[model samples]
Target: MKIIFNRLYADYLMPSRLGEYEAILRQARDLGYAQLAVRDFYRSRDRSPPGRVLVHRHDIDSDLRTARKLFALESRHGVRATYYFRLCTLDIGFMREIEAAGSEASYHYEEVATFAKQWRIRTPDTLRARFPEIRQQFARNFDSIAERLGCPLATVASHGDFANRKLNVINHELLNDTALRQQCGIECEAYDDALLRHIDIYISDRKHPVYYRPASPFDALGRDRAILFLTHPVQWETNWIDNTRCNARRIIEELAWRTSASC
Candidate 1:
């Protein structure tokens, strides 16, 4: 089973409403989920993740301090979760603290480095001038982040740097760089099938499977072992309008697609 957590929401509430996040922690505890997976990434550098705060780029230090409070809250609730940080924002000391707290840390690879390298908008001359430095910086960022976290970053996930269409295919290039994953000691890539297998293999193919779609929580009553439930804690408690709309659309789209395919 999978439970989705939005790291940004925890960060958002930490500064203004710590209790709200604590409430989420309580809910996760109530749900009997031993691990809570928190997804995190750096903003600025002229790009931001899908729903993170962009203006906070003025100071990375402050942002990290805020993020730590969230980890602390979860710890208070007696739940340990994986913190998936992007390659650009790895802080060794912070990661050490996370590990000390008995939490797991892992990678959030950006797919653009592997598949969308040629999609730069600059002219060949300009591209030649900027490409090497960009790639070098990105690689350094990846390495440093991986190093700070120590302990052979085991799990894998993505930061949505590539297009959504590409994600549907379960691309291994997301974390298959032999030099990197091997050097960093990252274990299994969290492809969809792998996640499904982690929950229950009966509903998922044991080999050559790319993805598995589970019914939404709204429709999961009487469901069996192979369950995957994704709920944004921040959205659920805060009732964030945008999260509500996005999830509504996802449910509607899934239902429509299922109906069409079944016919």
Candidate 2:
């Protein structure tokens, strides 16, 4: 089951393993591309670098430990990347560590969508009607992030939840409201038009069956003059041994979820 899971989900889970991620960082560095965290990149828009630039952004969907591992790798390579962590993965100490390492520490919000699930909001009309409450919840969540981390919150990325897809709602909708953004005191959104306008190529290693998507990390390597490399930390491991072990747990958890859902 481990092998089958690994083969079927290649780039989706643990294929962009730590070793591979390290190699990519080295390659990008060798090709004259210095890593820029998302917050830094957005904040320094007017002073954008002329040479090759790589914005390596990670969305912490599942594991904080894996994020720490990725952070260590980037620190060793002298690369400053961006990490947008979900509320579920927030660890104040680790976030402080990331900031100290010269990387950007930010949020990965999915509150609006998660709330929609809890409220049983399935239709667009219902979503709109309850949006005011959901928006308030969004700001409150940001407050928690700031208070818990005891630091300033700047840039954030919205997580795409399964609920959002099923409801035809975009998670970033919370950030879209100017008033809500002001309430949260947010600086930038990862998907903000201003930030994305400068990216020459957008590459993401989201969940997908190995065969459903191409598997080469090099697919965008060194080819684009400016690149936004988005990845999930949970989908990476240090090596095959770690990857297989992690996959085993993932499989069992998945099976259990399916079993319970079917009941």
Best by lDDT: 2
Q: Per-residue CA lDDT of candidate 1, range 1-263, in tens?
A: 11133343432332344464465445434544333332222111123322211110011112344456667776777655555555444567777887777665665565443333334322233333443454445456566666555665555555542233332422244344555556545555545343434343122111011112343322222333223232222322233453355456557644543344211
lDDT of 1 at 21: 44
- Can you give the TM-score per candidate against the true fold? 0.48, 0.82
What is the per-residue lDDT of model 2 for residues 1-263, given as tens digits with 9 covering 90 to 100?
Answer: 87666565653443445777788898888888868898887877778574788898999876666788888889999999888878767788988888888888878898877776665565766776777888888788888888888788888998986567766888887667888787787888989989999888887774434421233546666777778888876566434444456567557644543444321
Query: Where is model 2 more than 4 Å wrong at Cα?
Result: 1-16, 207-217, 238-263
Q: At residue 174, give the lDDT of candidate 1.
A: 36
> Which lDDT values do the candidates have, in the order given?
0.42, 0.75
Per TM-score, the best of the predicted structures is 2
Q: Model 1: residues >4 Å from true position, as ranges?
A: 1-21, 36-66, 111-143, 162-172, 176-184, 200-263
Provide the lDDT at 111 for model 2: 81
